[model samples]
Target: MTLVSTATLLQDAYARGTGVAALNVITLEQAEGTVLGAEQAGLPVILQVSENAAKFHLDDPGPLAAALAVLARTSQVDVSLHLDHVTRTTLLHRAAECGFSSVMFDAGPLPYEENVATTREAAWWGHEHGLLVEAELGYVGGKASQVESAHGDGVRTDPDQAREYVAETGVDALAVAVGSKHAMTTAEAELDLDLVARLREAVSVPLVLHGSSGVPQPTIAAAIRAGITKVNIGTITTIAFTRPIRQKLADLPALNDPRQYLEPARTSVSAVVAEMVATVGLAGTQRS
Candidate 1:
């Protein structure tokens, strides 16, 4: 299959009432594994590269973006590249040039008015370049500190505000804070399905659930049923990839070759991706 547009994929999911898996990729192995897993499940997936991941590659995302583009073009399953959680305007502008089909302009940390202004500008640029733009409404806390509430009582996205924001910003998708937190190591987050349904009814675009790594499989399915069209998963894949490598190193201290451990790590990530696809009820489903 060739590289596909994220908007097209998400629109299909939205119309079908299914959620699309948007898996994060920080390395070549992760990208390959994501594609492999999607192929295994016969599903379409979005391969995401976050701003943090770009910074990890010496603050230059071109090489990794190019690599992901190649992987997407050669993959057995339909794959789309998404630039996730991008706060910098430069990075947002580089999305189309970097082979990205969509970008999440993360101005959620900013005050509401400022967030609206910045996101609107981003959405305009993205549309001009034929890229889907996704923006967040509130801070889905968890990456900075685990102790913080995943669903900050007053920080959850209000359905009324979300409708206004989507109207004002003209974003193609909206990521709302229901009850999931980022960087969570456990799958115990309970989502506000009512809020999800409300947001879905309020917004004109597709709904995205970030911090989904912490959401249980059943809850994830429920969220999809309630209205989540895109699910962002990262931490779980990291855990899966690292656990096998840690065990492999502990069992064989003499294994000095990177490939020896990374192969299993990659396979582990693939398993996680495939499982997530199934959880979202996309496994074995054909992409339109």
Candidate 2:
């Protein structure tokens, strides 16, 4: 299958009523593995490079873009490169230049008015370049941008404020604060279904759950049923991919080559991705 652009995949997901998987890609192996997962599952997946990952790699978005281009050229599945949780205007512009089809601007932490203003500008820039722009409103617990305090210490997104923000920002999607945290090791966290339904009734644009990994799999599916069109899974996939690598390296002290370890880790990422695709896209029958 030809690699479909991010806009087509996202729009198709919205139209088909399924949540497309947007997996975070950090290292070269991760990108390859995500592409493999999408190919194996026959689903179009988005390769998301978050702001932290951008800085982690010395502010070089080039490698990730190159990696996606390689995947797009070679794979039989559709793959879209995306920039996630970006706040800096300079970095956002850089990602656009590097061939990102979409960017998720996280202005939720700032003052309400400022969040709207900056996000609007970012959206305008993205629209000018024909890129899909997603803006987040209301602060959720355990966002990576926050420090010194963890989840449960953060503020929840008010439904009215979310409506106002979406009305103000004109974003393609709106990430709202429900109950899930950012990086939970366990999958026992339950989402506020009532809150989700309320927001669904309140906001017209698609709703995005920020901390998806912490939420239970069933709750995640229910969130989709509750009208969430985009679900982001990062922490769970990271833990699933990394813990085994840690163990494999620890067991084999002389293991120096990453291929010996990262190969099996691909299976871990694929397993979680497969599950997400199966669960979220249950009622979604249309395919591009």
The best candidate in terms of TM-score: 1
Q: TM-score, each model? A: 0.95, 0.91
Q: What is candidate 2's TM-score against the reference?
A: 0.91
Cα lDDT tens digits, model 2, 69-118, are 78877877777788999988888888778888889988878877888899
Q: Rate the local accuracy (lDDT) of all candidates.
A: 0.88, 0.77
Q: lDDT for model 2, on a 0 to 1 scale?
A: 0.77
The candidate 2 region of ten consecutive residues with least summed lDDT is: 146-155
Q: Per-residue lDDT of 205-281 in model 1, one digit per residue for the tens? A: 99999989999998998888888999999999988888999999999999999999999999999998988977875
Name model 2 segments beyond 4 Å from true: 144-154, 283-288
Q: Residue 185 of candidate 1: its Cα lDDT? A: 92
Number of the predicted model whose lDDT against the real structure is largest:
1
What's the CA RMSD of model 1 in angstroms? 2.5
